[model samples]
Target: MGEPNTILHAVRVSLRMSQDELAQAIREDGREHGEPNYCAKRNVQRWESGDVRMPRKIYIRSLERVTGLPIEALGFATPVFGTRAAAQAPANGQESARGEVVEMGATSAPGGAVPMTKHNDHGTLSGIWLSRYEYHSSGRGADFTGEHFVVVIQHRNKLTVRSLPEASSNPDSPLTMDLTVDGNVVTGSWREETAGDGYYAGAVYHGALQLLLEPTGRKMTGKWVGFGKDFDVNTGPWELTFKDASTSKAAMDRYNHRP
Candidate 1:
């Protein structure tokens, strides 16, 4: 009816929610790198009214989830985050001002928020993505029964993941694994520690995860291996998709790390 509302404001309206409702929802998502009350209603007003230059990556990521709107549609100019800036980011769990995810930056528009920075050769691995793997032994013939719930965290180019078995006694327990990306492919390994035995037959569980980026850049598919005494003993396939497509809403597992 009237002139179109500002991009951020329009998104909030499209969801039939008030600014306070969206603000409260964003605060609860709670980015590990964000501050207390960071997404206050006043801040939302600022972003909606064009008072702020660019929303930081943390808020951008959280708001995407809160509003179910793509960050690019919010209309802020994306800024490129350099290596120096990333290295200089706060070390006390606080994050620096980052817009673009350098090595693994935005490729398209469905999964996470789009970076406002100039396009570059490097790609970014920021934002949330769900990982699913069904592990089975070579001769076990169990129809890939070992299922692990996994989530990936991409900050700049460095990546980390926390995974736990679906039937695990310790669902609160997460195995911290790290990986690096080469082109669309990502590979890494982590050693796991648990009080009880693993989901597999033996008590030991250590493995490598490989992911191939889809053309849409929002999804990845790969295989993972659960190595035992001789290495690469147990193997299976895994898939990673954005939060919206995931049945497992356990998307924020990255913040579960303890000091």
Candidate 2:
């Protein structure tokens, strides 16, 4: 094909996703943006092969949301005309300047958009948070507490949380929460993969979650209902508290060392 979009290919590889996976992610992102996209693996193949230098406007925006990178940074050439640039810019009051999509109410620095932290009071759900949950285990004969370091990211009205491993050698149980926000209520679903050698024998569990966000926006208290190892319905308390506004080395170390 053309010169081979190495940058696009490298990003997909870095994400540990195959062509089909990337396509699916882009499609989901597009749907969230109110632009339904039927992206297929063949489309991704064409993009990586440089056969399609620039995708449609919806696909470009979806790629930006999925990768958190500007289109130009992803090896797409910038539009020369102002009208085209304006059309491709982020909608709903978000702006694109110098190929950077600036979040609403976010100030631009000399080089890039200012990093939105908890101090900004922008009501953003992006940062590191401490997640604590309780579950009753019949085998243990009592309730047990489990905690993890999670990274939260907010895109529009959606919030996604993923558990971070405490250490390279000792990985955390894989957990993911996807929630939608409406005023003070947060409703979502959670899925977790247990450790293979654990008591449950690596079973996968998932369920619904409903939480209430405090007025301060720093904490969320909720309840989760899921099926237990014995196939019985179980409900438990779950809480997420703001820990760090940034995932710096120090913040990660502090959480990692928690007993």
Candidate 3:
């Protein structure tokens, strides 16, 4: 908490990013953490100027995420000195030999919820989510495998979705979404449009999906529900795993090139 976090300021300058830009990046970087923590430019200013004695631990964590730097090296190691990782205890009367109580909803800040671990949904969310869904309808069932790229508008909490076509999945279908992200949980609705005739045509469904932002922010567990023109709803469980370079370029390229 000393020296005005010179390291943070230096990193910002080295990256040629203004405080506003850095604040926005940090905010967006945290959206996957369930109701993302917000940090304003004024907060950044306070941190840079040492106007605030200590930056919030969450802010430091977010800064590390955005700058790809380490919090300890940033001269703000006090809050994290004794931090420990959180682990889930086996249920049904199962107990560790040490008999430590496991609290499932531990938080991020000091003395808050359990300590953060990898995949606690504290990472970036603007990437490709490769999802596999197994759905069941009245008398039929199906498995769907596809890729979806959600391009997030930084600091706005809004995103546009584009899904790759595979096995009867909609092609060139674009979805507009408004999501409410709470810590480790994301619940949202999307409006889907299509060109066709009859009940299954022309923006037939405004679907909803509830997802948990897992530790790595890459592995997501959720359910997507949609009501069709006939009013019958199909329910499914899905797994959305994050994709990296070689696997995710298509959607991003399309997103960037759109006119």
Candidate 4:
């Protein structure tokens, strides 16, 4: 087997994120950029085991965004042009599909401008969050409350939030939200897949949402309008609160088991 990618592994550990969390983060990041990604725990395992020396270009971009590190620094070999390697290179001034020129010593990190620091600030919504919602069920004629552990990733004006499974062995009934930030208002859409054995009978739900960011930037309060199991339009209050700046396993467990 090839040498293990300790650099990649170490960075993930420092961020207090597990392999599964990293994979989910990367997948969410790809979706934010309109890229379809199938990243999973198995992919992270291969990368850390050195079974795959270099991932595809889309994964590379996601890695850069999640880790705030340059590809070369992550133990990946960037192709250097000129010398014998440039013999088969594209002609000069010719750009790749992404408009990047393949030339001698042209290795540039996608997020080189961003400082390599732990994301612990409120300036960007890139961390763990607690999602809570309350809605009245027509069948029961009572209010129902739900909570979830979610990871929020913000890339520029775009934000993606995805719920995490309670445990590795448990199946995920994922809830995903895609939102855009304009000043202090966040407008977005949300989709959720109900648990198969739950009260909803594994129904799929989706709707539009709009939230106002609190002055502290640690809380978002909003309302969601969606079709319920009865096929009737329902509205409810939804909120997301900043929980932890780190995605460590301990943080995840704490949020998952919240009271």
Which residue runs of candidate 2 sit more than 4 Å off their true CA positions? 1-122, 167-171, 248-259
Question: Candidates 1 and 2: which is better by lDDT?
Answer: 2
lDDT of 2 by residue, 85-168 (tens): 666654322223322233222232212334323232337877778788889889879977767777676645557676665521
Which prediction has more favorable TM-score, 3 or 4? 4
TM-score of each: 0.40, 0.53, 0.40, 0.55
lDDT against the true structure, per candidate, is 0.52, 0.67, 0.50, 0.69
Please report, as a residue range, the 10-residue window in candidate 3 with the lowest summed lDDT.
Answer: 100-109
- Comparison by TM-score, 2 against 4, better one: 4
- Candidate 1 lDDT: 0.52
> What lDDT, from 0 to 1, does candidate 3 have?
0.50
Clashes counted in candidate 4 amount to: 1
What digit string (tens of lDDT, one per residue) describes model 1 on residues 41-88? 876765655445356667878877775446754545444435776655
Q: Give candidate 4 regions above 4 Å deviation.
A: 1-122, 167-172
Judged by lDDT, which candidate is best? 4
Off by over 4 Å in 3: 1-121, 131-147, 153-169, 195-203, 245-251, 254-259
